[model samples]
Target: MLSIFLTIPLTMHSQSLFEYQWKNRLIVIFTETSNSREFQKQMQILNQNQNQAGLNDRKIKVIHVIPDKHQIVFPEKSGWQNSNLYQKKESKIDFEVILIGLDGGVKLRETNPVEIEKLFDLIDSMPMRKAEMRRNDN
Candidate 1:
């Protein structure tokens, strides 16, 4: 009788699991709310689609910025209600999606994820994305 011991490599798999490669790409931040399960499910689906589309190198980071008491101010105070992106949209009590460029500057700020495709288009049109595509084409 022969006994064999097999060791599973956990580090590599774990790294890939939590490692999103969007450090220099577009940042998609979502405010966490009581109805966060839906957003989480949507994000999971989006990640799956991205992987299937061969966009592994173009990772999208989904950040959940939980608002504190002081941070929870009325939207009307900051002209948020009048913004084009927020005018007619109705969101849950606490929810937001902020799109930021690679330089850490906010590009498109919205109160819903319905316009996420626009953010993708904006990122794809960025100079970095163009350069990366050119490099890959070589």
Candidate 2:
């Protein structure tokens, strides 16, 4: 939820992923298409109303990566962003999910559809998340 509306200049779009580093944790979903089964399931899991509070609390921003189009769909934004992070050749799989931490590192990788709570649990177990919880408890 941190700086969710902040806009970055186009010149730095290549480093847009790092633009979120330290400010928010990321759940990047790389899928073949926005309408794929895995993509739909993932979106369904994310759109649940009950998960809103937790999602905001954890500062999670979801990015949908359409490898075929070589673009990333950032939340609260309108069109696709061309990202070099995704290359169809680089990933042979059709559906892949990656959890990135505040330090700009990949924390988890899942090939199939995963539940939201599972992701939340994984994030909650992170050392940085522990520290963040401690800080918020004050």
Candidate 3:
């Protein structure tokens, strides 16, 4: 069952789960157990490419926060990952990856070992993403 879920691919699952309403600017991320250093490095690369693309820099903004359960949330897995960052009282957050939209909506969520190109494609294809960019330039 786990393998089935894993095989579904983050983008496809997220799109369906989000109902394609995810299009046109939002946050997308691939999180994993923090102990996975390779995942972190991959995330770094994704961010770098995104930065160069000027995607988040223009209209939309993408962010990745590493949640520290002990420091941020006492119980840790108690919905902290799903909780709205603003709603949480803790000053710190722990997440393998987080994608938030300009409107503060979550686009997609997943664990690491993802296809980075798919993420980039998703960003490029957002209908509103480009519009937001144009609006920002003005």
Best by TM-score: 2
Give lDDT tens digits, candidate 2, residues 1-138: 113222222212453676777898887787777688988888778878887678788998887877534333434544675664556223479888877778666677788877988999999998989999999999
- On lDDT, the leading prediction is 2
**lDDT per model vs. reference:** 0.42, 0.70, 0.39
lDDT of 1 by residue, 1-138 (tens): 111011112211321211322353333334545247655654555555444253335544444434321121211112112112222213454565554444444555566553446666776787877777799899
1 versus 3: better TM-score goes to: 1
Kindly list the per-residue Cα lDDT of model 3 for residues 1-138, writing each as its tens digit: 122123324322332223323342434332334344755565465456545455434333333223322111111122334323222212223333434343334445554434556656665565666775578789
Provide the TM-score for each candidate, comma-separated: 0.51, 0.80, 0.41
CA lDDT, candidate 3, residue 137: 83
Q: Tell me how many clashing residue pairs each candidate has.
A: 0, 0, 11
lDDT of 2: 0.70
User: Distance from true position, residue 1, model 3, in Å?
Assistant: 24
Find the number of clashing residue pairs for candidate 1.
Answer: 0
lDDT measured at residue 127 in model 1 versus the true structure, 0 to 100 = 81
